[model samples]
Target: MSTPLKPLPAWADVALIPLINVAAAFVISGFVVLAIGENPLEAVQILITGALGDLEGIGFTLYYATSFIFTGLAVAICFHAGLFNIGVEGQAYIAGLGAALAALYLGFLPGYSLVFVAIVAAALFGAAFAFIPGYLQAKRDSHIVITTIMFNYIASAIMGYLLVNVLRVPGQMNPETPGFPWNGRVPQFHEVLAKIGVHWPVTPFNLSFLLALLAALAVWLVIWRTRLGYEIRTVGANPTAAIYGGISPARITIVTTLLSGALAGGMAVNVILGEEHRLILEYTAGFGFVGIAVALMGRAHPVGIILAAILFGMLYQGGAELAFEKPKISRDMIVVIQGLVVLFAGALEHMFRKPVATLLARRTTQPPI
Candidate 1:
């Protein structure tokens, strides 16, 4: 049998490969743009400029990135423990009730304190919701993939019932909670800046972006700098070996799902508390599903997740502007491009790995005359 190729350097594994995938995705997308009678070069320029051209654009980009960062972290943590937790969407959905309950009822506390309560409540709710699947997987031999998939449907039904029958404001005809009071609001970035005499564009971006970054740092510390992280990685890499070493796989599974669901719950800080100021029907808007692509593209690393999240943010914000600027390129086309990026960056992520690794190996081995 032919010997397997060694892994690429860490830097290449993390950054270079992703960059190549993104570039290939863009190239293929360019062909699509050309086929549709648009100048591919101009489209690229427009895409970049639209995402970064102005303060508002930048703000919106980061706003989109914030929830994605939470979801990405959620996915990354469970991947470390070798679990494919697909219920982030549902977990986040349920977490909204926690955020909304705190925002709607806890109006007496100081602004910061109230927001803090909401954050904790959201995480707790999400963790509780995810606990069942984790327990089933660990103790009952239920497949996590199947269970989480079913959980998504269950979450949707539960949320739909609550929104329509229970949480709807009196005679409001909207499937949503009452709007939060000013005290319950998470400070928007522009509002915070204006208080300090710096004028910033009013955008949905808020303090949660900073929270996301902090979450990323915490994930890195937990996964790479702690005993639990080592245990998680060990169990994930080889559960048989982990069992031999006295590590309990069941405990890890339950703990990993708890942490994953908690991270997923953090999305409420960005969507409900930070932006919407209320829990609305379908508030997730597919961000939880997008997290899968972000995690795959990010290689389940915190730093990589952050960068990958930002790239997707660019796609969203830039895609909107592109659709507006070019009538020929509809929102559907933008979605097609997004699909291409996801395809190359996620599902086909490792397509070029062997060739690239082989090329690097040959170059490293070449001797000077």
Candidate 2:
């Protein structure tokens, strides 16, 4: 009789795999630093000092982390369901524009209720934008990567035209909509913290950081505790097997895509509601694209995504400073670092998987008949 196959390791049990990937990324980053003739230790110190050197720096780090949290989680959700979503950029753009329009025109409501409405509208628009691609994929078997990338271009052009024509403020020469009303903005928590002699970061970090933490927790619960999540995972693991077992892969795919888009939409709360309090041409600034790298490095785990998000946030905040302080180091160095992290993580998975399976098989096999 053939021996039964052992189950694959739980994510928690294989925790070292991600750790190894992160460690390898750092080593690779160090090499890049050396190749550029910079002392890796000094570069690291600068990065750390710039990210957390002072209260202001810490505040900035948190600000950046907030956006990272949203996009990273967006990417993570689809990845968990074995879907590759590359449309976060477009989704974010549309969502931000939607929020901006709501805040500008809908803020006339008598109470603070408009704030919640704006957020919901943004999320809904993002979901709708994503649903189109999801439906096409489910119905026609279209490749998600190609469709999503095309959607990104379509979103950018559409948003651009709207901003230049329909959404343009009466007097503003710039390609942007009117600033959001006071009620629509995320309150400045830093000012309150300052009264106690504690300064919050002026960057994207703020109440959104807490929101990101809560989102991560919620995602973890959904994935590990819910029947829907089980179905998603089942389909991800093997669609034919899941179909035979009564799970609907198409439904799961569409649901997963919608959820991913909603997360991307939530990112606008930080941009249009928190920081800029308005929608601008460069509002997304590529955070959506960065989410892909974050998700890959995190391996699509909620907690892992949070940690990876913070790391990317730090790189973004610190890299800006590095460019300003040491003009010799290009801001593009951050991109290089991020790319290396993704590469190391992807490569490490293959490196470890074969060895791990071989060892496990040896351990489980019967030695003698």
Candidate 3:
């Protein structure tokens, strides 16, 4: 005999489900910690402290969070449009080329002006990378998933070729471009904090984190307050009905995907402009792939995505600390934990759905006395 399930409230659907999923993942991860002769509770404390114990840790956590925020928003936007865009990794990779090109050629401009041009270049290149797959899906009835995945490989290959042949710095064996001029370098977080008479630890965090916040606000406004957003949602909800209502699904798909790619490209601001100050091979470092997990855990909302990105940043920074503090726990162990999180939050999301629904159904059906 099974209890019937009911739909959860909006708040529960958005907040509770993901929380439950994350809790379950952590519980399972606890066992792995215990198996390695470490106390799970102690491990949890270490993770929290290592990620947020001091200004330095906090800065690094936020540094990682900035990238996740950009990629998460990119994924969330595409999800809203009923599109599965998996090319963010490749898009960011390709966008780095454009950013590097801008830095190389526009070094003569003032720092602020050069930064603006570099940002536009990255967005344009990323959008152009995604445009072909989007066009194919919209006009040629091609599967977006396949085309986007293939594009990732193509982008990677192109990047490799350019790095090795065209952009490789002379006398530098590594496959990378020369460092951008100091004038083009973005200010670091500590420098900004100093301006306000606030002492802060040295870390890789920078102004790009603030840009991520602005992007989130912009996304919220675009998705909820604009006419174009309404048309996008309409087409995503029901394509045939949208067509009847004079909304073109194909056009919306292409536009949404281009927007998604541009957002992903903007991640280079944190990497190229803020931290590296140069273009390097594989600079994206899997942030784009992790974004899918962030979007899933966030339920594809901008606010939710920001929270989820912070959580992932904690995982990344804390996981590194764990590896250092306890030699018994290797980096691969942290990866396992991350994998479990994504597994429960995304691939196995329904594991708790029926049970939650049943509980909600019971609550709603009880007699009011």
TM-scores for candidates 1 onward, in order: 0.97, 0.89, 0.95
**Which regions of candidate 1 are displaced past 4 Å?**
1-5
lDDT by residue (tens digit), candidate 1, 1-369: 976777899999999999999999999999999999999999878888889999999999999999999999998899999999999999999998888998888889975788889989999998988999999999998999899989988999999999999989988988999998887778999999999999989999999899999999999999999999999999999999999999999999999999999999889879999999999989998899889888989999999999999999998999888988998989889888878878998888899899899999888888987
**Top-TM-score structure, candidate number:** 1
Q: Which ten-residue region of model 1 has the weakest summed lDDT?
A: 103-112
Pairwise TM-score winner, candidates 1 and 3: 1
Query: For model 3, how does the per-residue alpha-carbon lDDT over 89-148 read when each residue is reduced to its tens digit?
Result: 998888888888998899889757887788888888988898888999999999888998
The residue-by-residue lDDT of candidate 2 on 249-361, one tens digit each, is 89998998888888887788887788888788868989998888778777788877877788887888788777777666788887787777778766555555555555677
C-alpha local distance difference test of each model = 0.92, 0.80, 0.88
Best lDDT among the predictions, by candidate number? 1
Give me the overall lDDT of model 3.
0.88
With a 3 Å backbone cut-off (N, CA, C), the pairs that clash in candidate 2 are 59-201, 62-205, 63-204, 63-205
Each prediction's number of clashing residue pairs: 0, 4, 2
Candidate 3 lands at a TM-score of: 0.95
* Superior candidate under lDDT, 1 versus 3: 1
